[model samples]
Target: MASHRKPRGRSAGIRTTPAVGITTAALTSVALLSQSAQAAPAAPTAPSAPVEPSLDEVKKKVDDLYHQAGVATQRYNSAKEKTEKQRKKVDRLLDGVARRADKLNEARQELGSFAAAQYRTGAASETATMMLANDPQGYFDQNHLADRLTSRQKKAVDEYQAEQASATKQRTKAAKSLKTLSESRDDLRTSKRTVQRKLGEARALLSELTAEEKARLAAIERKKEREAKRKAEELAREQAAEAERKRKAEEAAQKEREKEREKERGGGQGSSGPDTGSGPGPGAEPGSGATKAAKVIGFAEAQIGKPYVWGATGPDSYDCSGLTQDAWKAAGISLPRTTWDQVKVGTTVKTADAAPGDLVFFYDDISHVGIYIGDGKMIHAPKPGANVRVESIYYMPIHSVVRPA
Candidate 1:
């Protein structure tokens, strides 16, 4: 009975198993294929957005470089002018030395003629030699003088020749210096152009990025601009407050001065006594010289309506250095052309020690100079796109004080 049951069960299982196995395998393959198709990532249909530079940033770069190049050009020109002037002086010296050498040669020639005359007179036979003799003593008696004269002339010629040689060497050196200066000027010009081109290229790069990048850059720039504007406004307010303070102080001082004058007048004749000491004059501090006070007054007087220039030292439109030079010139003191030199010429003074007419140098390397107008303030041509105005010294990096003459 067990054997019969086993055989029947086996038959039944075999009858159903082949078709079920085929169906299961087919379904499994279909599911695997579907999964494979879904799991394989497709190639990116579209590209990521293109990056771009900020237009405003590029423009700012252009302006900054342009301004810097302009300043460099002005400095180069100033140095070039100085070099050329030195060259001219050297040339004049060379010419003078050459003339001295020529004069010595002429003296030598005259002495040679005299000596030849003496030789002819002594020889006595040659008629041409006799005619060459200028001496009434037939040249023989004056032979010693002729010989001495020739020696002196030769010595003079040698000394003059040496001087001329030195001058020639100096002229060569000066010419080389001039050449170097000219080349430097050219290089500065070329550099200016290259920087300008770079700025333009940066601007051109602005178009390459996507809108998101552009927006990010714009946001950054806007934040920076807002900060700068806020700083500017704060500075303006500070300056206005300072000005107000100064005005109030001046008004109070004026009233006090008037009261003193009135009291002195009311005291009757000779009651005020001899004016022993000069008080601190207007816009001037005490413990300073009358000459300094006069200089300050002179600068203040000239400040009425002048046009500002970036780097000009001029008789008309003036820059920082120009105004200082002209102002000191009015005070009977001469100053160097550039701000750096001007700054170095004066005695260094602290802000507390700064006197009227003391030159106030600002910016690194002493590039900007102005007249100290008392109260830690100065009048100067500030920068490009700015005018000649009075401002606090705290607004800038002060270099030092410069005395005049």
Candidate 2:
């Protein structure tokens, strides 16, 4: 009965034990396990299958290169367009000069023919014809009309002379113009060559960068754009705030002036009131520095119609410094001819202390200048894509302020 009980108890223990039990002996002998007891050798690793690049990877690279090529093509097209435009302008100028030259030559030839005809039918020839006439009385009567013939011949000669002179002058001018046009054409050709070379370089460079790199660069560019836009909006807000402050200041000054006038009128019956001239009051006078500055502002206003010139100092066209010099000169004040020289001609003033007609310098190297026109507005000959015009002070970089002598 004890043997039967032992067998049952062992059976019961076996039944109670779970199937997943790692005995100490099994764990110790894992490294030396029998082949049948071990796992199936990781299924032979499938030989690693030497993977060629995927279709998607090739497509991605191709797509990146294609986009780069497109960008390069677009740049090429833009350069071609610009070159063509400039070439067209040069052609037009040359054609106009040639046409004027041809017209002048034709006019000269026609006038020459008229002069020759008049000379052939003139008084001397007519007198010779009348002397040889069969009727002597008819000859005398014709001779009496010699004075009219002489007058007519003189008038024709004078007109021909004037026309020849004009034609010669026009021809000379046209020749000069053609020379200049030829130079411009050469320049355009050089520009076209340069653009084509740059386009080739761009295309070559496009072949080098990989798809992943392109994506990474694009991400960076987008981030830069967002940052730039944020900065621009911030600058714009600051400008708006400055403008509001100036408007309030002007209003306050106007109110003060009005109140002062009212008090003078109401408080004095016998006193003659302040002299109010439509012209500059006692605050402005010739030779006065501040008054001269006001006149400079007036001079700039007068030249609102003048065209912008890149490097001109002018009776006609002007760049930034050119316009400033001309405006100040018009107001009987002399300033330097260049922006750099002009920068040194005035007393340095803070931006807040800058008044109307103060010279405003701009840019990292001070490449631009403008005359402050009060209330945060300034007049300048702006950059290449712009003209001599009035703009907000906040539109460009403001380096410093200078008050003129």
Candidate 3:
């Protein structure tokens, strides 16, 4: 068997994104492709059926499913990375085992030659002749050293034994690596099925909503956006105030420096002396960070409107971290592949302190992330059915802010 362990299962909410392929993932990909909180709706219910969930309940349910799918997407990314790395290692191991097998075969051939040479000498039993060298006492023991193992037979036996051991060791390692590689692939596939299942459920939910309910759902989303804008404006005010305070402190410090310089000048023509320092100027690093940030922002902007593919990292589509990682790559900085790791890379800062190009993570679980485009907004891939677009950071629960360079 390629693998001994079996595969596992998945859950749901939305299915609008073609990336999930609502029709495809319900089976085949995963027999345990877990149906989300509920089984897919059968034929539309009769007039006397139990009342359907309210639009608001349906909206919340859809959001929850998408959130689960987003988390699954990150898992998929992690598993994919693992699968790729394991594949490379497995390849290397298989090649080494093959080489060891070749060496073992050569050793066997050399042993055969030794047996044939003995047979040419008109030996009674070739097996016994070879065994005489392997088991000395069986033939004649040390007393008949001349009749026992020739140095050539002894060497051939040793070489064969050594080659056999090496090949066995290599085979064991290759098997272990192959097993790990299989497990990683299974993990990747399971994550994918989980995402697809959740998306399918969400699609099913939406499919059942009445036209008026869908419109009402849109209205609810708009209200959320408006609320987000209000929160963003408040954050902007706080940032502006903080900036002014910083400016005042700098002004005071400058006045103090000027006074001290005057004291040094006494009563004569005074000049502002150069502040001599070592290494690259203080502005050098920040200037570089700003430049990189510009590149990152620019790259993200260019990607707006692209579909939100679960694990995509590309010019055409992206998941949250994929988009950020790709954008930073454009700016010449390497970011981790998943939001969990990406959050750990850059310095953490306040939302008010966030600048364009910072990563704004969401949910306490830290499952979602987006590039902060300032003004309390971020450019993110959003959810499955959505596209890469600019949205209010307040649209989701705030986790923490990170300034990924």
Candidate 4:
């Protein structure tokens, strides 16, 4: 049995074969290497196609950023004004504090002099002096002298203390105001820098586009401008038509009224009434509102090619508000420096009622301003990189219209 049993246990399956074992091990190792080589990830493939924005999308994004910058510019202007005002107030307060401090020093000196006089006087306790006095008259005299000296010294001390306290309070107030002024100036600088950065980013974005893309964007802008101009023209036509209709109706009504009066007076020829022009004619006086409006419009037109610079109120360049303010200034009208303040200086009127030289504020914050130049057109410093030019009033969201003169 031992000889015939297919090799017991471990020896049964074991091939006492070293060549097969070596061959199997080598094959397994080769298979593993091949598997690993195949299993390793392949090198990364080429990148996917990039998504490009449409021309309109890019324009809108850039316009929104510019609008934000405009808002920041106005905030910067406001902060600057406030900082200046606070600085003046602080200076005044400091001056007052110096005067008060001088008064306090003088009061202290007076008090010290009174104390020295008291010390020099060989004064004793009132009760002790009264007990030591030999006669009633001497005691009475000593009591009166002590009372008078004490009263004068107390008064001087009280005045010095009061003055010192007042001076201290004023100094504290002035210090706090100075700190606030510093903070406001810092905020103004931050706002200005933020506006500059936003404009820079917008410029960079515009520059990054391909030549074809740039052409497309320009074409889009031109198309928008054309559409806006057409719409404005249409509105002007409608308004003119309405005005003509109203004038004809009014004239007819006047004629009818005159006819009734004539019948009551037994019939007589009526002299032609004054010309029913909407405004003063060519013969208008030089100082009339229409004349002033013409002057303002003329000044604005002369600045057509000027650059748009934030916070500028100059002859060579201007901001939106600055242009309007200075143009009105040229017409002998003084407008506030900022759109927010300028808006409050004039009578508010409807957009339809707006006349040439009327100030048109735009955006919810009233950050942008332009002078209406009749015919639904306005002259404005559009934005950074854009020159002052005539454009349709409908180009921006209308906040309000004001007659500055």
Candidate 5:
């Protein structure tokens, strides 16, 4: 669902951070942005080849390519998930078909035995019915043996026909499923190729730069991260102020209610009733489902240093959605495999209201996702060559927030 990220806008009523792929070069190994991290600078160019893009241009191109690759990776994840399900379905169907075929064969054998018994009793003229009929169905029908057939023999005929029909139906279904499975596999391959191509293009662009240019790009990424931090801090401050206002409002309401309760009780000094919704009681979790959020975040945090691998759902490495999906899975929630689907599961929340364990999606396309760990930050698997890490939720433009728990 993700697309080209538009130029950033200044802070508004609510805010989110950058997507993982947006400034991925900052921490990647060797961090070249033809795509990921920085290297050094480029050698002087000859006058004729003015077509070469400037450093910033290269950075933008590389970043765009990586973002595109991230999108492709989601497609791969989708197809991979579909293919797996289809494969299982196909297996079940094939197994059923095999069993039905066996039954059908047994019915045919039983029918043949009935025909042979009749032939031995001088019931039919064809020599074909004397032995097990290789093509006996035609011979039996032509001889009009139904009037002579016993109920058991008739039942065998009906069962043979029914099994044949059922087997045929199931075989067709299995074939359709297999065809779909093959198509899904093709789609998976296409998505994988697209991801590879995008990353390859980004790396090619980065390779053109000299060591110093690469270093400059890395520096820019570092600044980007710093800016992200600053934005997060600013958001945190604003959130704190908002929380304070809400607190004061609740306190005033409580006091006013107490006054009304006092008047009702003839000003007697006694407990009115236990507070209901003024704030969390002692030892209460920050929000409902906070305990589940903690488990999701805890699982995410433990994988912080693992490398990012597209389409991976893992103990070793993970893609952005892969990490989130697995984190929630650890908490006993089964999430759809792609970012697009992941965003659709839980209740949508305002960015400011996002709690720990909520899914934070990024970009208009909904291409990236992270597990919100609160404090205006989220933990995500950045792009290729980058490790799973924590960054401001505003690291990329937030598409929406979801409480996946």
Candidate 6:
């Protein structure tokens, strides 16, 4: 009130601003911040596209899948073989069970006839008779007719019971064997499907590559083949050298033994007919094994261009183990249907001691098998696309060598 009256510029010590002025300033500041925020740009985001694998990586992955497929294929082949064998066994068991059932029926008919004859004679049932007779000996002695009838009836009942029991046991065994055969058949189908699926995946992956990539992959394979050939040649040379060294060492040992024998004979010359020692003579012909080997090699060579079919054992197409099994079969030796079983059936030999017709297994799983054909070479039906052909044994990593013949 005092300031309203008259002081020009210095009316009161403190002056208060209007509320509308403070609100207007705050609103203006908020409007300016909103406008600035609207005008500012947003931060950029990173890319979201996925990176593709290189051709080499794809090839490697496909190769791994192919190898896995090969393993599954071998498993399928093994299961198929087992299923076939089990089916045969089950058939034989069923036949035996049928025969036993027939015998049981005959025995039961004989027992029934005896029971009927006893009933016609006004005799009690065998069970009732046995229960009623406190002294069986006295009862039979008093009635010789009953004694003869009961003795025959008792023998019939015993035979019938034994036959029934035997038939039942055989039926139970046949049922279990049939169940196992069914399971093996199912397993075979599963393994087959697994192999097919893996191979399909590998094929699809390979099909996705460009022509240039395909060419590049082919070149890589060629290089590998060349390297394998070089290694095979070197191995052949080393084997020859080793064989020569062994021959010289053996010759020297034989001469030393001959010298010892001569000295024992008072320095007189011994007869030089031939060294009748453990080893073969210098001019001895190759053994029958060599003939069998030749036959195996011949059979394998005859099937040089056949297609490779998984789980196949035939004169047409063959799998890795199938080709080997059939080849040995041509030489009059029977081999199991799969490599896993075939490997166990034969005598294991060293790689250096491997002869023609020897089964050379490859990979750590022993999924692949080929017939060794000398000169560090083997005949094999390689993977799906490959034909039965001769290649270096060292083309793949060797697991072991087995001689089936």
TM per candidate: 0.51, 0.35, 0.77, 0.73, 0.80, 0.77
Residue 50 accuracy (lDDT) in model 3: 88
For lDDT, candidate 1 versus 2, the one ahead is 2
C-alpha lDDT score of every prediction, in listed order: 0.61, 0.63, 0.83, 0.83, 0.85, 0.83
- RMSD after Cα superposition, model 3: 24.7
- Candidate 6 global CA lDDT score: 0.83
Q: Alpha carbon lDDT of residue 378, candidate 5? A: 91
The reply for model 5, stretches above 4 Å from the true place, is 1-47, 125-145, 269-287
Query: Poorest 10 consecutive residues of model 5 by lDDT?
Result: 125-134
RMSD of each: 11.3, 21.8, 24.7, 7.9, 25.3, 6.3
lDDT of candidate 4 over 139-238, digit per residue (tens): 6465574455567655664576578778989999999999999999999999999899889989988988999999999898888889889877986887
In model 2, how large is the Cα lDDT of residue 93? 61
Model 3 lowest lDDT segment of ten? 7-16
lDDT score, residue 174, model 3?
88
Clashes of each: 6, 0, 6, 0, 28, 0
Best by TM-score: 5
Q: CA lDDT of 12 in candidate 5?
A: 38
Q: What digit string (tens of lDDT, one per residue) describes model 2 on residues 1-405?
A: 356453456766775564335465576677567654765665655556687655345434544443333333323333444455666665666666566666656644554554456567662444334324575345646566435455644454344445545555666665666666566556546544554454455455545658885676567546655664555456456656877998799778777776687687786565475533347745477677678878899888877657765445666766677789889997777886656668888699977666788999876566568898865667887543346777767665588989887
Sorting all predicted structures by TM-score, with the top scorer first, yields 5, 6, 3, 4, 1, 2
TM-score of 6: 0.77
lDDT order of candidates, best first? 5, 3, 6, 4, 2, 1
lDDT of 2: 0.63
Q: Whose lDDT is higher: candidate 1's or candidate 5's?
A: 5
**Ten-residue segment with the worst summed lDDT in candidate 4?**
123-132
Model 2 residue 294 distance off true place after TM-score fit, in angstroms: 3.1
Candidate 1: how large is its RMSD?
A: 11.3
> Which residue ranges in model 3 land beyond 4 Å of their true spot?
1-49, 123-159, 268-287
